[model samples]
Target: MIRVEHLCKRFGDLMVLKDINAEIRRGQVISIIGPSGTGKSTFLRCLNLLDQPSGGRIEIDGEDILAPKANVPALRRRMGTVFQSFNLFSHLTVLENLTIGPIRLLGKPPAQAATTGLELLRMVGLAEKAHSLPDEISGGQKQRVAIARCLSMEPEIILIDEPISALDPTMVSEVLAVIRRLARQGMTMAIVTHEMEFARDVSTRVFYLDEGLIYEEGPPERIFDHPQRQRDRDFIGKVRSLSYHVTTADYDPYALVGKIEGFCEKHLIPHRIAHAAQLLAEEVLGVLLTPLAPPRAVPTGQIVASSALAGTASTGPPLTVKVTASPAPSGPTHPDIELVLAFSEKQRSLEPRLDGAGPPGNPLETANLPDDFALNLIRHYAADIGYERVGERNRLRMRVQSIAGREAVAPIPLVRQCGAGLGGGHELDSATDGDPTEPDRFGRLARRTPATGMTPHQRLSS
Candidate 1:
């Protein structure tokens, strides 16, 4: 019913919509979504000539609405628009609001317009609110009246721009329910919305706009579940902090490994990074389970103090881990894939001194006894490590870098799972005595060991 070809809309030197082309068929709902200011609303406005385009053609039924001689007003009458705000005449009653457009524009008789207005109000479940003024009704009711007013015109297509954005959260669902009913009744719609789930559920097609271009468009499943572009994945991750968050109290390092593996496989993370991530999770959680692990050391030079009762403590504060997989920041210096692991510990630990002298010593150097196991595992699997104090809690972080293979590339893929790839991991059994129930014991995994597992500082000098 509507065709927009090579459409471009610009304001002054700023271009909003560029070379946009879309077809809105009867009963098909196309949703435009993106970060704010990408021109979703402007594109919707351009469709109905509410905002004149800078270039290109807009057609309805093969007639160019952008033509100088086009009957623009008449064309607009054939399409209804619902704005973000409930744009109802405050002086008009709900019934009158619906009838005025039909009576004024369509020249329908008062009696006929009234009859149709009442029917539309009923369809929107606002029959009882027909006599209420705009301010006299809730935001949702006002929006329903606005929708019915648009329907009273009986347009072939509806353009809704953030229809529920101005409504209260409690009222959003009410308005969405009405829109859903309209979709079910075969009313064609083009919407600009930030309501992700709603758009995914109702849209026949989804358009992701960025920097004045349709970056991606497809069925909801493809757009949401399998975004092929790096920008798309980054945008999705930013919008949805989609990560694996787990708190382990019983110190089941293997259980955490299972969770990490599942998340990586489901998200299609490379096998190498997934294996390294799983290994890292096991190593971190194992330390929490072991009673022999040193008490959180207070930062006081090389001076180390111990809590006597800590030796008898059976359990510790819950260990919380959050892992997020995202595209690395783009630059000449950043890698392609970044896996971040955040470990939050309630107990105190010696802060790694920047001056390079301390009891726990520099994490850059050899780990003292038990600490050696974790530091070794992480050094072998991950590319970088960091530690900081968050409030009273200590947070240990690790970042694994996996670079994409391109013409200009760096050979960096952390610990691939296969027998002879990246970091060939070894068992933690070699790091500790072979007692599975050892008080200070952590867990281990089997993978290729890194060619350089020990840091230079940890190496024995001849």
Candidate 2:
């Protein structure tokens, strides 16, 4: 019933809404979502003329409401707004709050207004509190009353702004339940909220606001599952990642482990899961890939061998470890952690790779081992592991799983002597030749030496 075209809103020198265009169809629930300060609330206010536009046109029912002679108040009567703060009159009783709008604006008789108010109150499951004052009720109940009050006016459409932002976690669901019921009952609404799952469930159309405009708009499935824009995908997926580089055999394993732990804690991952991630980093970098690192030179100017494992040479390029954490596709209760190890060698380029050949098989099988402890321990903590060749680099990906409630896997005994096979024989020195550096907000390590030019893939055969 409402259509906006090239709508713009400005306050003094700052422009908030720029050339915004959207439509709210009858019985359609449209949800506006985006980062803060993106003008989500400002857009809602402009629709009801609570915030006047600096330019552009808004047409309600084919009538240009922005016209000077158009009846703004009369037009607004057809639209109701519910604010985040539950703007209920303190002096009025619950029943009075619901009835006053209809009585004063709609010109309804007191008894008729009260009867309608009581029905709306019942719809929101707050009829028993009809006589209670706003201050006497809980935050959730207050918001429900506010919604019922908005509905008592019998408006054609409603605008709700961050309806549950101020409520406690326990109270959020109650207010959302009321709104869900409204959506089911065919209430045309434009809601600006941060509740992603709720918006995905209830909205007929989702609007992603960014850069002061409707950056993307689509059905819930398309918006949440397969957003076409990069920003939308990043925001929807909630992806967080960290990367560390290992150039030489002397690279400090403890520093890498500490970084992993800090990343997990920052993301609020479970302790069991965090421990598993640390173990994976230690094994993959310190033990499994130690033979692949370039040799280091000692103070005596003698080059220390990187690996003592037979047939294994220190000819492989530097390795990069990347850790990414994201909410599971099924739900958000448990997040999924991914570990990727990438390194290149000079030999793989000499052989032709078969098309569609999957992963050249798992690297764990090819790495000659003396025992199964390290291999089995790796398998215990990792839910899935695979190897793939991308260009000259060989990448191994592991999906880390939680060890909670499962049989505990003890850490492999450290083997200080260089390569005694791929069985935790690699040494992890406590002294660091390179200084520890801070990672950027995106979790990528900074002030690190770049990896050498791409060579052949030698660690894993394709």
Candidate 3:
């Protein structure tokens, strides 16, 4: 167990940790979360005397570590620290990295240390890499080896400072998975990390620091979802907006929908608008799953007949849909829901040219109409739509009115034409006699079929 009393750390005239007081109990996992340069890592460093505290008392197992007579090295040995950089000796093999500390620092026999090192490597799921050099392993693997080396000392508590921060996007999960396992096995830890979602899911207690002080501290649900402080809310919102990324594969539609659902729920989306927004996402994503027929100048009335019937199971890569909530327009009272769907990079003979879709005018008319199904679906559900080529990906931006603005209309219309009032609601049960494909809960066609039932605009007037 450890305790901090009036903890303070300063570099010259600049204070990094100010009058911080908190307790870390045995077997407890505490996460320190905050923006960069907020003293989160500094607090962790001060705990182990890696950075001497300017003034304050830090007691570990009833001994004040800052005392002149206290054995700082021995006390620190009881706690292990994992840094952002792997910090493994480049010349040492994985097994050597783990064994060297125990043999030299603890004075254990080389044979005993080697056995313990092998066991620690096995615990971190890196037994096979024991012979590999630091440079031979991946960033994630090296981090895992770092954790294993820490365990080789048999420390009572672990200090992890952004253990996954240096890893590639693809390697982060592996290292986190190792840490998560350690937590499950009851390893006491104090982590300073930018992994908010991981901390929310794993931490027993959360310390949200701001300006070198614990601005808010509590359980993850309270800190992450229902923070009592305005700054906390703003921080959480900014983090959420920047951190969300989800990929929806061609055959699996639920992946994207699930992400949207979780995102909307987290943002406290209104019930009426939430349902409509989700429906809009489902319809748009569903249309994207199917392959579009080559573009042609089809008349408005025959649009459904010409393009809607040509969509089939696409063999191309899946779409990646990213949704983020932005501050509402200059005069609007609610947040703006923006959805950006990124298509595959593979060149295709059937791909429609972005410039050839239409001329500038009303979005419903001027919007890209390469695929009638997608065009109609967006026009019916979104207030704005635009398309462009970004690098190797084709990106589409879609926006819709917040639920607060449309809750008065029951069974919200699928499409509200330019300047049209919300009237004649379209029912989900419309009979598509011409096309046998059944509509989903969101009224999206189950398969490539002619748009039979009443047209979105026609239903708006009835």
Q: Which residue pairs in candidate 1 have backbone atoms (N, alpha carbon, C) closer than 3 angstroms, thus clashing?
A: 272-416, 424-448, 424-449, 425-447, 425-448, 425-449
Per-candidate TM-score against the hidden true structure? 0.57, 0.58, 0.55
Task: Judging by lDDT, tell me the better candidate of 1 and 2.
Answer: 2
Clashing pairs for model 2 are: 345-456, 346-456
RMSD of each: 15.2, 14.4, 16.3
Of 2 and 3, which scores higher on TM-score?
2
Model 2 lDDT per residue over 1-462, tens place: 899999999889889998899988999999999888989999999999999988899999999999999999999999999999999999999999998988898899999999999999999999999999999999999999999999998889999999999999999999999999999999999999999899999999999998899999999999988889756765676545566665544567787778777776676666777776777676654333423431232222122333344345545432211111111222112212133321112111010111111223334544433333455556667644555655534456655654542366444322211112222211232212123365322122323234522111111110
Candidate 3, 1-462: lDDT as tens digits: 999998999999999998888999999999998888989999999999899999999999799999999998999999999999979999999999999999999999999999999998898888999999999989999999999999999999999999988989999998888889999999999998888899998899999988878889999999988889756765665533312232322324466566656655666654555455556565544333222311344333221221123375434322111111111212112212234321111210011112112122222232233333444444445544555544434444444444443443344322222212122212322424224366432333434325544444333233
**lDDT winner between candidates 1 and 3:** 3
lDDT of each: 0.63, 0.69, 0.66
Q: Indicate the residue-level lDDT of 61 in model 2.
A: 93
Q: Give stretches of model 1 more than 4 Å off.
A: 238-462
Query: Can you list the residue pairs that collide in candidate 3?
Result: 380-414, 380-415
Q: Which candidate is the best by lDDT?
A: 2
Candidate 1: count the clashes: 6
